[model samples]
Target: MFSLIYGFYKHMVQKDEYCVLILGLDNAGKTTYLEAAKTKLTNNYNSIHPSKITTTVGLNIGKVDVAGIRLNFWDLGGQNELQSLWDKYYEESHAIIYIIDSSDRERMDESKEIFDKMIASENLRGIPLLVLANKQDIPECMGVREVKPIFNKNSHLIGKRDCMVMPVSALTGDGVDEGIRWLVDCIKRNSYLRPPRNQEEM
Candidate 1:
């Protein structure tokens, strides 16, 4: 009888956990975005300045509880050498945020190439995607309208999952709240299909 009650107590105290992946090319502001997100979602988090946040060669993790669900973010490195390691995390991710360096027009093609690979993967089927056009604070940076068409060309590979292209400036922390709220809601709606992990499973 005691064991039964203990199990029930544990279950009530546990929160559903979801894993989110942050992927993009090097200097696409992936780390900056991660930091901004942490500061936004978690109360009183002192975020590192965007200029001081360097490239991630491996991963930077942040856990934040939204409502009752816990989101675990794995911010991976974006260098050419690191791109190959992204797929290894797909099997565990519930959603993906693909950061785009909108200010750097030259690397758009290269970014698309990598993004296509992710969309083509069977492992990522049904996983939600959020494309954040970083550096929107720049005077000449591409906006959501321009960035949309570039990724739209690969729509064939996206399947019928929830995907959105939004504008954000990690440096200035604009649009971070809306973007994260959307992601949280999408994952909740999809939780029945891909159920979030429990404490032990995560």
Candidate 2:
């Protein structure tokens, strides 16, 4: 009887879809990460070679259903010119996953600058943020400890938001699952903060 009621509730309740924006500087493994995630979650299970994944020219979208929740990822282009277009999608996004190239020490400062500006946006206030310290598979790559402190100064920006920095290797898919799990949990807990279903309501 209990099992029947739980089944009924699962069937009757509509699954919530959340819009997530994937942002980072060029060559930060944003596209690779997206493709890797799709390969793992969807039936299309083709292998994705990260080395062959070129820079994203615009947006590459992919959807995956996890534990009955649909996650729509907008993998935006990370080139310098494309950065200006990011704010256009900000109001619609429920969460953010910012990727950083852990191996590229020279660009860390540049990445932090862009991150600071993003978190300062009024439209993104209180939104959940997950920072992926990507390229952990590479030797000599900066780990979470080394890269996290750079954003520590701007911690106040996310004081009211759910934020986390996690180490991940987009190439090998290590740590990606754990990071995404945390993000899903955060979104579930704060579903009220999501954008309205219809634009008319906004």
Candidate 3:
């Protein structure tokens, strides 16, 4: 009886829309990471279909099917000229993945500004984030410890935020799978942590 009720609840009460918007400063390997994720999931199931990847001029779409859960990933082009366009998609996303260039020291300020702008936008506030310190294969690449404080400086989201900072090598596919799995778990459990909904008139 319990199993039947749980199955009914799962079918009726939860209609999930899983989406992730991958954002970062330009050349942060957003495209590479997407390809690596596709390859990783495909290899796990022995899928031979090649993923056709093109430069994400404005947006790139990648889909992953896992246990009846559909994950739709968007690769947003991260350039100053393209930044204004991101606001349009903020509300539609369930998660935000920020990629940073670990070896580039000169653009840290700009990257921070972009990160601030992301959550500050009217529609994106309260969204969870996963920060990836990419280019970890480089000898001069910055580690997660060195880059985390910059993301944590936002006091507005201190208690309400959820972020995972990790160093990854998109070239070597070192930490790509872990990152995706972390995102998957976050999406699945997002509503579990939210406070009780107010009983308001519909």
Q: In TM-score terms, which candidate is top?
A: 1
Structural RMSD, model 1: 1.8
Q: What TM-score does candidate 1 get on C-alpha atoms? A: 0.94
The TM-score obtained by model 3 is 0.79
Candidate 3 lDDT trough over 10 residues, lowest sum: 193-202
- Residue 177 deviation, candidate 1, in Å? 1.3
Model 3 local distance difference test score? 0.76
Query: What's the best-to-worst order under lDDT?
Result: 1, 2, 3
The residue pairs that clash in candidate 1, if any, are none
lDDT of each: 0.90, 0.87, 0.76
Candidate 3's residue-wise lDDT over 1-202, tens digit each?
Answer: 9989887766654434477899999888888887777777764643323245445687888876554456678998987889888888887787788999989989988998888878787665566688999999999878889998887788675446567888898778899888878877776677454321222222
lDDT of 3 at 158: 40
Tally clashes: model 3.
0
Task: Report the Cα RMSD per candidate.
Answer: 1.8, 4.6, 5.9
Question: How many clashes does each candidate structure show, in the order listed?
Answer: 0, 0, 0
Descending-TM-score candidate ranking: 1, 2, 3
